[model samples]
Target: MAPANSSAAAQRVIGFIRRTQAPRQSPPPACPPVKKYKSLTEIMAKARYAVVERDDYSDVLCDQCGSGERPDELLLCDKCDKGFHMKCVRPIVVRVPIGSWLCPKCSGEKRVRSFSQKKIIDFFQIQKCADLKNKCSSTQDAKKRKRRTSLILHKKRRRLLPFIPADNPSRRLKQMGSLASALTALHMEFSDDLTYSPEMAPRSANHADFENGGMQVLSREDIETLEHCRAMGRRGECSPLMVVYDSCEGYTVEADGPIKDMTFIAEYTGDVDYIKNRENDDCDSLMTLLLATDPAKSLVICPDKRGNIARFINGINNHTQEGRKKQNCKCVRYNVNGECRVFLVATRDISKGERLYYDYNGYEHEYPTHHFV
Candidate 1:
C-alpha cells in the first residue's frame, strides 16, 4: 500500500509539471523590433572623453591687426596657415591674391623692405631739421631753434658714439669742435665757386681756369642719384660723413670715426665712361676717378659734371706706401642686377672727425706729387 501511494504522488507531481509547461510557439519574424543596448564604441563616443569634431569651423584671428576673421571672408597664409585681415596687410591688400597669400610675418620678406622704407623716411625727416638749423643761424629765433635741434641731435650722437672710434668718449665732442675749428680756419676753394665762361679752357696748375669751361649738366637720373647722397650726409644717420674744408687737406670728406667696415661712404653713380683701350695716362682730367680695372676690364667713372658728394672726395697721397698711413676708404665696384655699381666703401675702422681719403690710383706712385700738398 505504501509503494502504491508513493507512485501516485510522483505521478501527480509529473502531471502537475506537464500541465504547467506551455506548448512551444513559432519563431518571431526576422525583423522583429527590440530594445537594443549601445555598443562599447557608441557608448564611449557619447562619453565626455571622446573627441567629436563639429561640421562648422571657428573663424581665425589675425596676428597683426588682432582682429578675428569674418565667417564669409578671411586671408590665410599658404605657408603658416595664419589668417590675416586683408586690409591690415602692408600696402593694404585690396583684392584677394590670385595665388598663395602670406601674412607679413609669414612672408618674412616684407619686414625687411618695410624697415628700409621706415628708415629712409626717418632719415629724410631728420635731414629737414638739420638743414633748417643750418639756415636759421643769423636770427635770435634761429638760436633758440638751434639749441632745441642740438638737444635732439645730441641724443642721436650719443647713440651713434659706440660705432664711432674715440679714445676718450667725453672728449669726442671737444675733438669734433677742434676739427671744425681747424677746417674753418682753412678757406679751401669749392667747386661750386666755378662760374661759366664761354671761352674757358683747361689750364696748368699755376693758372687753372675752371670758369672758362662750360658747366657739365647732369641728367634727371643723375640728379635723383645725387639727392640720395645729400640725404645720407644731411640725415647724419649711418656714417658721420661730412664735407668740410681742411687747410692742409683741402676740401675733403671725414667720418666721425665710426668702427665700421664696408660702410657706404657714398654712392658713385653717374655717367660711367666705359673705355675699352684706356691707359692710366688717359685719366688727364682732374676729376676723373678710376672706378675699376682688370687686365682687360677697364671701366672709369667721371663724376665731375654729374656726381654726388663723391666728386668732392680728395685723394690721400700714400707716398711712403706704408700700410699704417694708407687711406681709410676704398673705391669698390659691385655687380648689381647685371649692372656695375660703384661705391666708396670704408676699408677699416675710422675715428670720429677723421678725414676720409682714398687712393686715386691703385698703385702708390707719386705721379701728381706737386698737386697733393
Candidate 2:
C-alpha cells in the first residue's frame, strides 16, 4: 500500500514538473472579426453630398479643363483670376510661359491683320499739275520779265513723284508695284491721297528749321522800350511768333495757330534814324521807310546787326497773273500795346504747309533780289 501511494504521488509530481518545464504552445489566434463596409450607393451618395455642400475644391485645380493632377501643367492668367492647363488652351503652349500670361480673348489676336498691298498707287499717277504745264507754254513777254530759267524746282518733288506717266507708263506702273511689294515686306501700309494735309502732317515739320522754331525772349531794354511805346499809344513787339517756309511762297513768317488779329510778329530792331530821303542818303536800299508817320521826315530802319526774320521777305513780282494768286501773307506797321512794330500779319487763315508772302513796297514790276542777298 505504501509503494502504490508513493508511485501515484511520484507520477503526479513528475507530471507537474513536466508541465512547468516544457514550453507551452499559445492558443491559435481567434479568427479576425469580419469588417463591415458601406454599399456603393451609400458611398456615392456621401461623395455627391460633399460636392453639393462645398462647390469649391480644396486643392489648386485648372478652371479651364478642371484638371489638377499635374501641378506643373497649369498656367495662371494675369488678366483674370483663372487657371488653365497647357493642353486645353488654344494655341497650346508646350512649356510654362516666363512672363504674365493672357488668355486668347484678353490678348488682341484677331483685331490686328496684315495690310494688303494691292490698294496703293503711284503718287504721280493721279494727275499732272496744271500750273507747271501752263508755265511751260507761256508767252515770250511773260518769260522776259520772270524768266523760266530762274524757276528752281525742289528736290523733294523727285522723291515724292519719281515717275512720269507720259515718259514710260509701263515702267512707272512696274516701279509702283515694286514699291508696294517692298512696303508690304517691311510691314508698312500705304494709303491713297499721298498729299500731306495740315492735320495729317507732323507739327514739327511745319517750322523752317528746329533751331529757329520758338519765340525768342525779349531783352530787359526791349521790355522797357515796349512799355515806353505803350505809354505813347504805340504797339509792343512781345509775342510768340515763328518763321516757316513753303515751296510756293518761299521764305515767310507766321505766328502760332491760335494767334490771330493784332498779333506781334517781329520787331524791327534797327536804329530809327531820321533821314530826309533814304534814296538820296548813302544808306543801304534794304531800309524800310515809314512814310505815313511824317512826309518830310522819312523814318528809315536798316537792320544791319540787329535784324529779325522779317528781313528775308521777298518782293512779289505780280506782273504775271499766277503771281497775284500765289500771294499769301502781308506786312503791317501796327501800334501793338503802344510799341511801333512791323509784323507779318496773315490776311487770311494760314494753313500749316502754306508759305508766307508779302508785296515788298507793293511795286510788283521787278523783284530786288540783290537786297535780300
Candidate 3:
C-alpha cells in the first residue's frame, strides 16, 4: 500500500509539471496567397501601362549635339520626349516619320555599337576608299597613254603613328600604378582619347562652328592618321611608352623605342570639366583643353583619374635652360570635327630609353614649373 501511494504521488507531480509548462508555439501563420495572372502577356501589359508620367519636350535640344538651334529639324522621341537631329540619327532620318518615333534610349536600342559591328565614321575609311578609287582611275589613264617613269626617290613624310602598348597585361597595369584604382573609384574609365561630359559640351565661344573658332584644321592625311591612332587607343593600344617611378618627379613616361618627330604620343584625355569647378581641387595632372573667351566657358582635362600614357609624362621647367633641353615632346591643341582635342607630338626625335618632357604652361607661361625635375 505504501509503494502504490508513492508511485501515485510521483505520477501526480509529473502531471502538474506538464500542465504548468508553457504550451508549444503554434505553426507560423500561412503566407498570404500570391495573386495569380492569366498569362505573362497580361502582367507585361499591366507593367507597360503602369508608368503614366510623360517627359516634357517644351524646350528640347538635340540629344546628340546638345544644341537647340534649328528646332524645326529636331525630332522628338514619342516616349521619352528627348530631341535628336534628323541627320544625327543612325540610318539618317531625312524627314520626320509619319507616326510615333522613339529615340534609341526609349526603344531599348543601343545608340553606339561595338567597333566590330559597325565601321564607325568614314574618318579612316575615307582614306582607303579614295586610294582604291584613285588606283582604278590611274589604271584606266595608263591604258590610254604611255606612263612616264621618274628616277627621283622622294622622301616620304612621316606622320603621327599610334603607340604599340606592351603585350603583357600585368606589366601595363603595374606601370599604371595607383591610376587604375583612382579611375575605378572616380567612376571614370581609362580612355586613350578625349571624352566630353554633359557640362563640358561645346557651347558659346567653343560652339560647333568649326570654321569660325580660330582653331587649326588638320589636313586629310593627318586626320586619317589621327583617326587610326584614336581607334587603336580605344582598343587599349598605347604608344611604346612605359611609366617609371621617380623619388622627386613621381611617375614619368619613358620611350620604349625611338619615337620620330611629329609622332602622336597620346591625347590628353579625361573628364572635361569647367575650370571654376576644379579651381580648389588639388589635381596635378590638369591640362588646359579649351580657353573660351568667356571665363565661365573655359574647360580643363583632369587626367589624375582618367588618362593614358600622356598623364605620366612630366613637365619641364621652362625657366631653366637645362629643363628646356630635356624636352622632347610638344603639346598641341587641335580642333577635330569641331571638337577641341590635345595631342602630344614629338618636338624632336626621341631616342630609346629617354624620358619625355613637355612645357606645362605652353606659350602662356601661366603654370609655375620651377620645381619640375
lDDT by residue for model 1 (289-331), tens: 2333232223344433434456556665555455337588776
Which of the two, 1 or 2, has more TM-score? 1
Best by lDDT: 3
What candidate 2 gets wrong by more than 4 Å, as runs, is: 1-264, 275-287, 292-296, 335-341, 363-373
TM-score of each: 0.33, 0.28, 0.52
Q: Please give, for residues 1-373, the per-residue lDDT of candidate 3 as tens digits.
A: 9999999999999999997895978889999998898977567545534421334434668887788777667786666556787766553453578867877667776433223212322211312334676546645543432211111113354455444456774444443433343233334556665666666543433442332246676666567667756654444344677665453355577887678777778778887788878887767778887777676777788876567667778889889899889989988887777777788999888888899999888875656678776
Candidate order, TM-score descending: 3, 1, 2
Score each candidate by Cα lDDT.
0.45, 0.42, 0.64
Kindly report which residue stretches of model 1 are placed more than 4 angstroms away from their true locations once superposed.
Answer: 1-238, 257-259, 274-298, 322-324, 363-373
Residue 151 in model 1: lDDT: 76
TM-score of 1: 0.33
Top TM-score hit? 3
**1-373 in candidate 2: lDDT tens per residue?**
9999999999999999999999989989999997554766455545544543563544656776677756667665655545667766554454578866776666754422222333323321233335754335433323432332133123221110010011243433443443334333223343211122343232222221221222233344334433432221111112323333333333344432333332233344444444443444532324443333333433445443234444444445445445656555565443333233454544554443344455555532222533331
